[model samples]
Target: MTQPVPTTPRPAGTRPPELEILIPAYNEEHRLPTTLRALGAHLSRLPLRTALRVIDNGSSDRTAEAVDRVAAEGVPVTVTGCAQRGKGAAVKRGVTTSPARWTGFCDADLPTPVTAVDHAVRLLLEGWPVVVGSRRCLGAQLPVRQPLHRRLGGAGFRLLTRRLSGRVTDTQCGLKFFRTSVARELFAGVSCTGFAFDVEAIARARTLGVKVVEFPVAWSDQPGSRFRAGRDGLRVAGELWHLHRARHGTQRPTP
Candidate 1:
């Protein structure tokens, strides 16, 4: 395990960052650098103050080194580590620790284009507390189709999630954002620490009365996905069932 490198701490009384984008990486030495560069370039043109943090999720490769290299190039990148090896755990750690007004996580492969962050920020500024990218929504375009087995598995997952959460399609989409405070509160109570975490998050949001809007996004099926359709899919199914049984009473929306 590589030790986390230190970065300059924010000065006291300094205004918190407007947005923090967390990319959960596991053995993404080849793909993460490109994603970070693209994200940095896109964020530079926007006026909002932003920071990027890559959560190294127990990656055995030099993913952390790649992040350090990118940061050296002035890409505004930082990194943290999660001993637990799950995307949900990494994202939860990142979001909970972020001081930014808005925070979110996207796939390391950037299946949804980095430009989707622009739309998410706009929605957050417009009083939407939770904004998520969706490939199953109307107007969404998938440039590259997923393999048939993956597509079938996704459909089944979506169906199961809808039954549990009601009409919320595409809970597994890798890009999602929330108001930082709200996100912290939500993640603090999160139970699932695996791929099924998304389903739990959305269900929790609904129980808490947080309005979640799914924005149609242009997405592509990227190679090197770590999802194991048979193994992980069954694990996710079990998690969903547990979420269905858990009692989550309605709570007041975060103000």
Candidate 2:
């Protein structure tokens, strides 16, 4: 599945980056090895200073041990334990704990390759408050193994998001980058702990007048996703409604 080219252009500049890559893992012991290896190789080739954060979300598996083993290999790796489940909770913990100039979180499965990290960092360097992988954007390529029903669900979700949030082309991409200031501001206000957290984050960023750039991503769908599309979709939709009401509830009075 080829991605559509992005109409949104990145702001331009050249700056050496202090980037922290945050990976939120849940029962990803088998997947972590490949993802970490790919990320390590990519970071080794880059000139930017990079640190890796693996937030273990109370996996019954050996995910924490695998991350510890990788950290022992001399990479600037840090692991945080979030006993609470949910990807959003893990990301919140990691972002708040990481001490980098710029912070970003990627799914531990590496559905989007590490090269996308470079792209996201470049967007941050260019002055965007947040940069995100856009699966709906041009140049994004999804793997053939992706289930059609999930794809259809994603399309519907993006479409509904367009109606709710007018400025974004994609809202649910797992790879996201944020400048430290932006991350601090946005994540502090984040209340969602489930799949709809991405939408909430993006909404808050927009509310704060943060500049966001959605870039095309090269993504591959991986098996063993813990997501249950139908069940999770209902939860996501309900959360979106809650967020919508919260935004309205918090609106400032006009002069």
Candidate 3:
């Protein structure tokens, strides 16, 4: 399928001049063009300068080509090819390689509105350790098209995370910001390379005394999601147990 060509003007660098937005895209050729459009439309208006990096996690489709198109438009996009796949591994690569002091990761689908992203970055500037987007927080305006089981599963996962990690609510949101110095260390220590990577990041952050702040987000579901909840659910469950064991064992990394 011929994808729509990107129409937005290139975004100028922002004021703070050191923020990097790391987008982990896997097989998102169909969705990335629109996602980048929305993000570019909003970011082009912001005053903070940022470097945008798109890490292609071994996509078998046109994902790399699509991102290369954006890079050709002078969008400050860096596409790194990785043989190892998974969201966690992709995020780790993006975080560890960033030159900026502040780094963030957003889903390629960009389910949250771009304005909300501005808010999260603002919170980051306000002295938060890790500024995270939340769908369960009060005042959250979520997508109307989410399936019932997905919502229930999200709630269940957050509940388990609360008990297991003893952290704030909503650990699975795709949008999360970290200080570059902290992210460099955090991603280096992360072990899980799949869906439960978020939990592992949070656990390691808390263990390392990383201050965390949650920001309420306006989120909407996008189509063409690749996650299989049933299969991933079992994987996450096992990861949770393994994470706990690692936390208690001598294998845990020192903060």
Candidate 4:
């Protein structure tokens, strides 16, 4: 149900990146530079080959230019514009176009430490097709917490979406990784585009019987988050209802 997202062209002879990390951005000109710097630094130390890309989701500001300015020494950063506007839409575009062995999307803000990538790569190479960071997991650490309202709303969201999420503890965590082929198959069926897209994606994974595992991480709540509790929460609630109904029939397009 997602429109096509374009890929950054690679020279025919070059091997694709081994690790492709996607960051979905909207008007992130100010914060993106720092994130790219930090992420690029961490990626440079890893032995695995890495590719960093940003999905500029119709940003009114110069988010793309910001990415251009803070170039990484080891981790080359590529910026691609997503015509689709929602965060999930941007992530879907990036994931579907990934040409790497391992692909996944993270938030523009480094809420989850970039080091989590180490464990993610480990899990994926260990044969887990899907791996996501979990704030609700046993070893999770929350150094900086989300606002009180967000914390409460997140709890309710999890409770309502529990059936769809299954054993996965945190579906909304921005840090998620997947083996390339499995990531594509799951995202190719994504129908919702807003914040609730995570719920829809998880539901699709459940329907397809794809096994998803969560890794605990130290999560810090970053400022300038665009998610409005009252308004966005209602939309997420509505999306959940639609997903529940879809479970009866006609949830996904025929392959």
| Candidate-wise lDDT, in order | 0.85, 0.77, 0.77, 0.84
Clash pairs for candidate 2: 3-138, 3-139, 3-140, 4-137, 4-138, 5-138
Judged by whole-model lDDT over C-alpha atoms, candidate 4 comes out at 0.84
**C-alpha lDDT (0 to 100) for residue 69 of candidate 3:** 87
User: Over all chains combined, what TM-score does candidate 3 have?
Assistant: 0.87
Kindly list the per-residue Cα lDDT of model 1 for residues 1-255, writing each as its tens digit. 766534336557867778989999999999999999999999998888888999898889999999989988989888888877788898898998898999988999998878898888899999898898999889999999899988988887787777445556788889999999999878888889899888878777877888889899999999999998778878787888788777545343242
Clash count, candidate 4: 0
Residue 18, candidate 4: how far off, in angstroms? 1.1
Q: What is the C-alpha RMSD of each candidate to the true structure, in Å?
A: 3.3, 9.4, 5.8, 3.6
Per-model TM values vs. the true structure: 0.91, 0.86, 0.87, 0.91
Worst-scoring 10-residue span by lDDT in model 1: 246-255
TM-score-best of 1 and 3: 1
lDDT of the structure predicted as candidate 2: 0.77
lDDT by residue for model 4 (1-255), tens: 777644455547977789899999999999888888888888988888887999989899988778777753444788888997788899898889888989978999889888899989889989988888999899999999988988888888889888777777899999989888988898898878889888777777777878788899999999999898778778778888888887755554222
